[model samples]
Target: MSKTNLDIQLKTIPESAGVYQYYDKEGNIIYVGKAKNLKKRVSSYFTKTHDSGKTRVLVKRIADIKFIVVETETDALLLENNLIKKHKPRYNVLLKDDKSYPWICIKKERFPRVFPTRRLIKDGSEYFGPYTSMKTVHTLLDLIKGLYQLRTCNYDLAEDKIEDGKYKVCLEYHLGNCQGPCEGYQTEEDYQENIKAIREIIKGNFKDSLGQFKQQMKDYAEKMQFEDAQRIKEKIEVLENYQAKSTIINPRISNVDVFSIVSDESFGYINFLQISYGSIIRSHTLEIKKKLDETDKELLELAIVEIRERFNSKSKEIYVPFKVNIGEEIKVTVPQLGDKKHILDLSLRNAKYYRMERFKQIKITDPDRHANRIMAQMKADLRLSEEPRHIECFDNSNIQGTNPVAACVVFKNGKPSKKDYRHFNIKTVEGPDDFASMEEVVFRRYKRLLEEEQPLPQLIIIDGGKGQLSSALKSLDLLGLRGKIAIIGIAKRLEELFYPNDPIPLYLDKKSETLKIIQQLRNEAHRFGIEHHRNRRSKNALNSALDTIPGIGEKTIVELLKKFKSTKRIANAKLDELEEVVGVSRASKIYNHYHKE
Candidate 1:
């Protein structure tokens, strides 16, 4: 398709809700999107400037455009989700789940067997869940088994077979685990009643089951059947215990799905919590790799549709942190307070934990990818024009205006480059003036880097407030490198970041990865500066004490120190030991000086 033809198609596109597909030159669909207004959404792609390189590339790849108009925005969303899943277009967010989840299945048989399965067969059987884990399925199954006497056999217990006496009771029946449904001991009506209660239990509704059990126990107690009453009491306790563990909020907040997201530059983690009668019946997190720098709202909307379909959820209501468009069929509630907000927070926490776990795994398995993500995150968080792959932080250390020194710590790809760390001895600055000290080092560091043709850091950090930042800026201006590198100052009081010429300081989230890396750099610079200052002070103290001795030149002091390791050791050394290291004349001068003191 030519550009002229593409413009004509865009003009013809209707201003209505629909799904659109962009095809590449090879006639393959590259992207699929949902829009409330097809014309406006599709036209914006071509008209607006995209920040993400991938989005720009996707736009340039378009050789043709095709769309299907839908009756409503919700329909458009569903269509987009299906088309993306079917075609898996090149520029769509990738949904990466491949593991088969477990489901509790009620078989379609004479005496239906309830068991956990990973495969779903369309045989008119009822499958309750595609649970997140096998452990949850087993736990529910165990609770059901403890509460009810159900058949767990594969025998054909037809009326004719029972009449002919072909099937017999198994060991499960003798062990009191089953009610002998294979024989005539349990009728179909009685078995169906138990099945109905089990269905409610599986749906997380325990009111009816608890009421029935309490009634049975009361009747047994009235008849003086103490053992039977006690057994019934035990079953009630089991059901209550299971419900207690599963319930998280008010029981009235039922049949709702809660979703929350924690996202980064490359991926979005959306956690879904299915609430049935205020109990969390299902919990899962979906990881979606971004293709075009999708927003959290967009990712959440798409993931809500995908996860609900995958989990076979028919929940009519959902709790979210913000409003979303996913059709009016399901009520979307932005929870603000009370139990609803708590559940939403829980979903967010789960998403954060999942993201953290993925980061840990990727750090070991794909380190380059981890570094790229951190750099990207820092770039966005700091509002930089490019990723800060190389960063340098400066800190000044001086005790009582003595031995003032500045340290510059280098970080490559968000980790310390210890070999590149440098220390400045505050040569020009006569006193403990941090601002002047910072200016001198900043100028000297970059001047030498330029002279040696070494690469300059993308970012520079000054460990002070606006005054220090302004001082560093003056140095950059003198070096003709102002605005070429991103620089900020950090104040110790509140961890506030001061940008040059900006009075309003930026405060990053304390827990964010960007802030953590920045804090690490600042601390490293401080420690490195303190260490150098301490060494300079110690060297000056040693020189002053040894230089006063007559005929003990720098060479003799060096040789004696090398042999004795310290001035104290030299003073304690015997005459022969000192003579062996230095000549007898210098040894006598050093020993006599220390003894006189």
Candidate 2:
């Protein structure tokens, strides 16, 4: 593009602070940027001296420029985030992994056993990870199983399989590692206590756990039970050793994110490490093949924001090897010498390792090329912050006026977070109004999120057309969080997927891998909502039959569930067995009604 075109574009822009964009011929996005001063930020690109290989290449393709004017630099900071998600122009940095991570699963039941796997689904289980290393995860699991003798099998106690003498104790029992709960080597009461202690350790309540272990050891020793105290002493020592080995790298820099970058002419790599309460979370990386001044602290701020949001960072302090500005009570300090040097060196190494990893992935991916296309097109379409990594989608489901529920599924880097999935037994809205239902669900979701002081999502995808879209908008506005989140409604136009918020539904080119990725995410969320809705419906029907019995009200129903496990068993119960249950009587009128059916 020429200076005359730039001048023509400048005629309508404001003399304020915000972000701007440049698009090439054929309407492809070429560059994305933010400005502390909108007028000055845009004007500088046209300056004759503002010439570099990167700038010149971008400027040459520029067919037109667009700008967003805001109140201050900070507003620009936030608006830049929204625009990046909306537009995803080709030139922005994306710093998160797209693959779903692994989580350690422990089924929620009378006897919970921990198991390790990458796949997570709704199975009434308590999940512990999504931790980075399988080796580390397995090692820890093995230690707990070996030392504590906890059950590692997936068999449910509810299945009437608690016959202790029937099954042989596994090798873990011989190693004195298993509690032998499976073989009745340990009393059920004692096993439950041990499980509670293990749970405290898994939850990082190490202090309380250690204290309890110490008390047990001391009590045994004082009672002249020297052998028992010695064994308990070993367990306490193991717990203490684990805590000691997992030391935080830095204590002074609380709530900090340290970043490092390594790049060359063909590919650039960015490594981001987030530290909360001082422990170093494994570093995350992004590769940018397209050239940029992105290594600078100002641009790095956007990447840092993505990292924090992706991990749901709880830290308030962010330490960077280079300087960058951000929110919270954050201090961005650059270390010049001394002890900080080792950390900076580590960050650089992390960047180098990541760069090499990307180089390997790029042999097949062409990451920079894909990034260039996505970033450019995204900005034009969405008008975003920088790039959208942590996008969350919401959907409401019901079956003919029964079992109303809403699902809030989070997608970080184009994949769903099963760990973060939420089910809302929607209480505020009634009937089949998707609009009012959506409005109530969205409001309830964000209102509590805001009160809890969680940051809003970059973009929110709702399932429906204008009615659903507008309902979401109204709820957002009512809660005073309208512009804080971008709303997109997915609607079906005739036979095609349509986003009604757009002037026209976006139709991806048939060969595009990116569209295939988005489609998978949308489908996953829909399946999740329907499955949760169906489960609730099934449970409600089961309970309805029991709820109507003469002696069985909601409370008695809850007690029966707590004891017998499920309605299937209750429905099939003989009068003698039902009468044997607590709060149940054989002569009660309920017995007559149940048997008559």
The candidate that wins on TM-score is: 1
Which pairs of residues collide in candidate 1? none
**TM-score of each model, paired residue for residue:** 0.92, 0.49
Worst 10 residues of 1 by lDDT: 90-99
Task: Give the Å shift of residue 495 in candidate 2.
Answer: 72
Q: Each candidate: what lDDT?
A: 0.92, 0.67
State the local distance difference test value for candidate 1: 0.92
Over 79-102, each residue of candidate 1 has an lDDT whose tens digit, in order, gives: 998898789898998665544999
Best by lDDT: 1
lDDT tens string, model 2, 300-405? 6776766665545555555566766665356666777754655667777888777656545764577565455444444345556555556677777777877778
lDDT of model 1 at position 189: 90
- TM-score, candidate number 2: 0.49
Q: What local lDDT does model 2 show for residue 287? A: 61
